[model samples]
Target: MAAPILKWKRLTNATGPSPRPRHGHRAVAIKDLMIIFGGGNEGIVDELHVYNTATNQWFIPALKGENPPGCAAYGFVCDGLSKILMFGGMIEYGKYSNELFELNATRWEWKKLKPKPPRNGSPPCPRLGHSFTLAGNKVFLFGGLANESDDPKNNIPKYLNDLYTLEMKVSTNTYAWETPLVGGDLPPPRESHTAVAYCDKNGSNYRLIVYGGMSGCRLGDLWVLDIGAMLWTKPTVFGIPPLPRSLHSSTIIGNKMYVFGGWVPLVMDDVKVAAHEKEWKCTNTLGCLNLDTMKWEHLTMEMVEDSMPRARAGHCAVATHTRLYIWSGRDGYRKAWNNQVCFKDLWFLETEKPVAPSRVQLVRASTNTLEVCWGAVPTAEAYILQLQKYDMPLTPAKTPTGNPPLSPMKATGVFRPAVVG
Candidate 1:
């Protein structure tokens, strides 16, 4: 059997108005359409761009109601209905907001939501570079940088580790914040991490899997939070792990969590250079985590240079049933200054399932000719046939055999047979 191959295809000739090159954007998939929200290039952007997966087109849809201000590093999620929920992000250099807004997917309208305060203290603080995951009717938010000082020159910011959920009240058309009382060990305060919701086999319990972030330094830890039990525990993971990174994207398909592209901080040997300058290393590597076996698998693809995307961070990735779409990220070219490069192109990572041909049959066509047939595999692009002759030796010596190798024959149609001599 042949190993399954993952292919990356760059989308071309996308029609309609394309969004400007920017990073720190947020995207969510609904059916065949992907909706992208705020990010920044020269400055912050508030325009909304929609990409149709079936048609390979892009368009800016006119929105109604009060539009949210231009911002980046915000949290966005689709409720699986026709609505997308957006939360905390930085609007500008010294500004961070905790405002919540909703986009009506079907009507193309926007509405600012004011959730009733939690029964306890105040709501979660204003932040950016956080993560949001939707499970059932609630959206979970965790870990981001909340600016504490008003001075724009003050680079140091406060990182948060608190977790909160926004529950929708359908009858009243409102939302309520709830801080669950969680037990067990919790992750440290960090920002620019990724979180994905995974359901168990029976579909009775849900878990939020978190991987990698930065808390003054890069992190490569894995933690899981049980929504029902209100517990947090670091799972024991096997296999080779990815390097410490932040600002990456993690998408869950089946029991696998696909992580791609992020920023890794660099340390310098010179004390003066280390103290005055800070550098980041961008990566294009991809990794997968198996939830069932608790193992990590790094995916390596063989493709041409132009076929793959550059090493980047602060990008957005959304997964469908069969494909993962990636777009718009900042590529830091390993320089300490003037190295930020924002992208405007789009790429698709195709994860094809392996399916072997079935109902195979063989028939003698002539004196030395034989025909082989099989049922077509829906997901397979090609098929392979192996033949062994009775006259050939069962075991080969260390010396060369000099025997002619068999070549593959191409057969078209669903049940077409290929003849061999």
Candidate 2:
């Protein structure tokens, strides 16, 4: 079988001042523009960077209103309006926040929302590495590390499995948070997992699909949350699944969810040492899950060595109709205190391609002649035709062919006016 064709091209000529090499940032597309905000390297980065997909240029717009302080690993989503909503992240190593902020895409302003009566008595705990997505008039948030301690000696972070939604009043332009009573089998508490909203064909049902993240170690589990029913279920899946990973990005395009680049731990023990030590590795492997069939397919691409981004985690990815944009992530490093390498470059994956022709037809023109027809292939320059004739099977009721009905005849021809007709 022929391998699937995929193309990855690193974007060049992104002019003007871009964000520094960082990770844990979030990006969202509004029309042709990509807005990137809030990541950290040496410290937290809170500035907003905008990239024009049409012009291939990057620029920072001066803003008004109160700006959120520098932070990383926050939840960000666009309301398909002029507003982009943000919530909950780590401002520093041991500090986390649950503040909500909005950015006016048109006016270039920031507004921190202060709800009079907070949802569920108070907002969700300050968190990082959570997944947030938009579905209809509501925004959903799930799973992240929270309640981190500032003390270096006891700096343990808490992972959560809770789910919350922000209900928006489109007419009045206000919103409220709601903690729905979810039932059924619940997934274990985890952080750094990714969730995407999937609406049914009739648009009557909405489902949020969650996949792969880390608890104490890496996890490769899949779960679904029915939005309307407020229930969670683990759907049985077929095909080879991706290995345990975290800090990856999953974007839904059509009936498939495309996952790109994350940290993968590889344990290597030294046999010679009395006390064997283990090592962790990271990868840039890419895969997709067929939502309709509940199957997983890992994609292998022909990538240029110099152009391909290194395997890393905490990066951000956003998808358009045909392309998946990956940008700004930390490189996979081994040591804790080692100077981490972050990327500022941008690259896109072209997931969709022209499909092969199908529904071929062969009509009998006469007793000894036939005409071949097929659907047009958009990317095909020409086509080939093959014809094979099999000998009739000998039976006891019928006379056996003496010469084995002669060798089956075979013919091959190029698809053209002279041959097809």
Candidate 3:
């Protein structure tokens, strides 16, 4: 079988108000837009950054109402639609918050859903690096490091394995949290792991798979939380699992979960003699976990021109159908880590391989006339060119002599050219 070639392309030359270089920030893709929030640079940042994936544009949206206090290591998750919810994070070295806030991406507004200490009075404690995953109407939050004290200044970090759910009443536009009575052998306390739900396209509730984090050192445990049963089961994962890692990001695309960029401990007995420079290493290696077979498969990734992002952890990754976008994370480790070395770059990893330049282009354009042309797609035989009347406000046109790289149009591949205006 041919290995999966990860064709990487770094995004550069983007103009507009972009967020400063930060780590521990979170990002989610809604429709065609990627929304970023929380995380830290020199200090914590509360502003919101939006990147238009289609146009390769960045805009720091002027958000209405109040944002959560500057914080990082919080729970930031998309509701798979137009809303993103945040819960519990550290404001600074000695301060943390358990406040929950909601951002309506469509309206670009922020509303505090559950206030600190919560109206229910039973919210999850102040924590960092927790999983705040949205599945259907319920958002399940699993393990993270938390401080048991009610005082914000007592920032002693304690690993927790407790579980809670916040269910949204979409009819009334409200939500509440419930501590589920979970059964089965509970996974150990940890933080910086990934908990992704295997939900339907419509965001129907499904299984929550939690994997890899750090307790004291790094962890490699695989745990599954069944939604209907309210139980946690440790699955015997097949194939060579990823090394014990923390602060990694994993996204479930279709039936496979893609894992990338995490702080991995490199003290395996088999690799004692390996010429590795560091005892711990941050890796940018990509691995796939097949949900159907409960097996992990190695994806042999081949990058074109060696353009992938470097090894880093605490970055955020989200998928738009077939494409994976990763942005900003911390790279070094231990005492060698420098705060100023955090990355601010953005990159796209094409899951498919050997990207060939598109055969479609704008052939000619005049003041009153425009002509577009395209050649056949490989193993395909049909093409369609769509020209819609320009209704959306157009910016002042740039150089009038450029062609946009073609967007793939899939069809029967059996018919000749057709144009619709």
Candidate 4:
């Protein structure tokens, strides 16, 4: 038990050659790179990797035009700009694709979107294990599975809870689809659930914290979506939360929300000669939900014994300010897998931080010479340290008498940089 601690740190010595095996694939982080796309290995996969978390390396994004045909349960994000979009999935014969692709890492290109009817059709429902998040510039799809004959016995594969909002209209650069101003509390049509987006300091708004999945059965319930006025709140926290799962993996730190692993169902009972042996067990537990004390924490692997990562379920963890970049998925035992085993490793969860020495000082602004910045601590305004103009080089070169880190008092005005050539 004390001997499985691969203390984490193996950023990718395998990305291409391991690009097949999949699981509800779709990763998105625009700046430091992590584009990933599509999934469902032995069948659907127009493939598109891009790891590079600051050069941890893994690249396979040749991007050509008209692409959105190869997929496996889709949904993507990253509107901080470099382009990503992607929508709908399930490709190859039993088809279902509402076509929409963007990708574009500065002309790598993909662009095939055309669902324009009242703005890209109101809300993602071409279905495929749904869940997507990217607030503040909008993009909030949820739930999934609504069509294309998966025939789970006349259920016709329709399990969507419906909640959509795209709204990224940068001067009609396109994307408008709205209608998720739920305002009346919703959360029921589950499909591999998991949605994060916090910041509700006493109702300043923005809180979409759903959890668990599979409404037909496995679900450890917990819901809240209150992006100010567009309501939905159900919080009654108190320790231990993470049981009854679906394709699991949720990440967010700052307002907490870190769930991992999934698949839970053990109904065995072959008593005499009858027949009953349902299965789907993969648990190395680790769930924490503390959107500022909505509590719930059960992190077992014998309590982070070796910094966990064994029981997987459609893997895709994403966080940075430190680490937490789990990739790939599907350890759902004997069911849906493309067999690349252990889901093609690439762990990295390092987080310790107690050492503090962060400073930043730059002031050349008497009225916009533009270099005004200040930081050294955060006695707290919730955190707002703004400083730009770094074409690269921030290791220890921000002099102005160097003790410079004094932001987080909301760091007052002035920030203008939208002149893109």
Candidate achieving the largest lDDT:
1
* Model 1 stretches astray by more than 4 angstroms: 152-156, 265-278, 333-339, 354-421
lDDT of each: 0.81, 0.77, 0.76, 0.64
lDDT (tens digit, per residue) of candidate 3 on 100-170: 88888888888887532334447787788889897667788888888766665765678998888888776
Clashing pairs in 3: 381-413, 382-413
Give the runs in model 4 whose Cα sits over 4 Å from its true position.
1-12, 15-57, 66-109, 112-163, 166-176, 185-231, 240-295, 300-421
Model number with the top TM-score: 1
After superposing candidate 3 on the true structure, give the runs of residues whose Cα lies further than 4 Å from its correct spot. 115-121, 149-154, 200-205, 270-279, 303-305, 335-340, 353-421
Measured against the true structure, the TM-scores of the candidates, in listed sequence, are 0.81, 0.78, 0.79, 0.29
What's the C-alpha lDDT at position 308 in model 1? 84
TM-score pick, better of 1 and 3: 1
Instruction: Give model 4's TM-score versus the native structure.
Output: 0.29
Tens-place lDDT digits, model 2, residues 1-421: 8766676778887888988888888989886678999887777878899887667899999999989998788899996668899998888777788888989989999999864334556667788888888987788889899766656356677889988888766677777777778899988888889999888788868889999888877777999998898899999998898766788899887889988878765752343321222444667888889998999976778877775767878888887646788888887566342256887789887677634455555543555776767666523335656555555556523226544322222222223321110
As for model 4, its CA RMSD to the true structure in angstroms is 21.7
> Looking at model 3, which ten-residue stretch has the lowest summed lDDT?
406-415
Can you tell me which runs of candidate 2 are displaced by over 4 Å?
1-3, 116-121, 148-154, 268-278, 335-338, 354-421
Model 3, residue 82: distance off in Å is 1.4
- What lDDT would candidate 4 get against the real structure? 0.64
